[model samples]
Target: KSKVSVIETWLRKHRLLYVGATRHPFIHSIRDGSVDVSSFKRWLEQDYIFVRAFVPFVATVLLKAWKESFDATDMDVILSGMASLNDEFAWFNKEASKWGVSLTNVAPQKANLDYCRFLESLMSSEVEYTVAITAFWAIETVYQDSFAHCLEDGSNTPEELRDTCQRWGNDGFGQYCHALQSIAEHHLEKASDDVRKRTEAAVLDVLEYEVAFWNMSQGDT
Candidate 1:
């Protein structure tokens, strides 16, 4: 796509979250040739990756359900802003529909103490909250494509289809798992070693199980 097309599409997907006041300091900077498109694109790309990686991890670890919807916070609004831009994203909606899956919600749940502790630790600080919220925005916008799909030629049976969906979901969950690990690592300079190690293990366990689950599918058929 042309740069204009890309920009237009991005705008459509994220216009809702854009600061609209032309007189705003940031807006003025951008309009006055200070902030450039490259800088803006960098931020957009980082937010996209963070959300894609973390959202599912939060859902699986915290919510325990694969197909959950998140609350419409500013994060959700940002995601909607980016998704509004192009017809290509419609394919994601269709693919998800095939398995009747959606993004997981970020609400409280009684999964496990370790999981709860990890989440609480992240949210306890305002800095971590900002990181997580930015990550969530990217996920709300574009993380559905990380997982692989079953062959579309109908060579697989319904049972195979279910297994494929499970495997794919696990793959997506693994990305989220990595996000947790990355965040813990990023914050470790401030956290105790014991706390850091424990948190890292908790996140790694989730990712490890997901890898095992996906690999196990290979042996099934």
Candidate 2:
């Protein structure tokens, strides 16, 4: 299964943990149906925004890295990749703009420093949803506690930040999905079967790690 599917399965199977009386009561209410899941749906929408904001930045960095790794003479491959990546980014940019988000220069703000750090931590290791809602919880906490400050002083509003976080999370997820799809497409072609399987498995492993990281009921890492 794709990482997204695996993560979704984990979310459905797990009971997220919360801390303190406030958290306990909030969790109870949600689990007991007093709070409902409408807000969760909206929060989930933020995932797309996150993907829209950072994918281009990442693609650009990757292109440069690829250039450094290969010869400058391989301009054709680099150009083709750039073209494909540009098309993808353009599509995401249009989507983000419709959501009132632009990725032109979304520098990492002070408030988002922790968010970035936490994401880096996850990316550095092979941990799964054991982190639970480390990313989500961080964004939610920021939203509930410091969103106003972010809106007044940051590049995007509190809603935008939350949306962006979710989008990034989803993009990580989409990467795994895309990798798997690529593997499957190649599998049908009977070319480099071993490489395709390795790529698919690697993406699945990443997806598993993400799922484990997000499934933590204990709240922030």
Candidate 3:
């Protein structure tokens, strides 16, 4: 029998933590149409900052991929992702305006700062390509899964948030995430045992950070 992929094994082993990141109470509130607008506003502002920080991390990943990946298409996929960030920023600005959110004045919350720091750590040269890509996959997957849940059938996600939800929840984004997963898994299959262990730990850290980010959105410390 073919063995389970590294990512699949880790996901199964850490199912609860994965669920916590993707199905936190804040996400449920959004799905139930009970989300406080203040919470949404807080998330909007904080996430904009997070995405700004995320750009550098993605760039670092792209650079690593260019330097380490044997496959030229790896660079192509990552480059496309980098190019797409421009559109993402435009959407964030438009949405913030619609909601009266002033993105310029928003300060990063502690959770956000912590998460950004984690990204910075992964960008170091000492980190292996396998481990860094795994963290990248986890970080993007959490957002993709969480927001996609809000768009699922039977969810009562508010109309005002539907656009925001669709931005990440759409099939195209899902496909992009799948591409990232494929890249991560491919690298992981050939990684050293030590690198694999570090990758697993990084995935767990990403989940914790995601949960804390949601908590911060809800005004929790």
State every prediction's TM-score relative to the real structure. Answer: 0.27, 0.27, 0.98
lDDT of 2 by residue, 102-167 (tens): 555544333234333444544332422212112322222322322222223332334433443343
Candidate 2 error regions (>4 Å): 1-188, 216-221
lDDT by residue (1-221, candidate 3, tens digit) is 99999999999999999999999999999999999999999999999999998899888898899889999888887887888788999999999999988999788999999999998898888888888888888888898899999999999999999998888888888988899999999999998899899999999999999999999999997
Q: Please provide, for model 1 over 18-124, each residue's C-alpha lDDT reduced to its tens digit, 9 standing for 90 to 100.
A: 22211233223333335343333332333233334344444332331112223323333334333432332353445445545442332222222333344344443
Ranking by lDDT: 3, 2, 1
Question: Model 2 — which ten-residue stretch has the worst lDDT?
Answer: 129-138
Q: Which candidate number maximizes TM-score?
A: 3
lDDT of 2 at 201: 42
Backbone clash tally (model 2): 20
Q: Which pairs clash in the backbone of model 1?
A: 13-81, 13-82, 14-81, 14-82, 51-139
What Cα-based lDDT does every candidate model obtain?
0.34, 0.35, 0.92
What is residue 204's positional error in candidate 3, in angstroms? Answer: 0.6
Off by more than 4 A, model 1: 1-92, 96-183, 216-221
**Leading candidate by lDDT:** 3
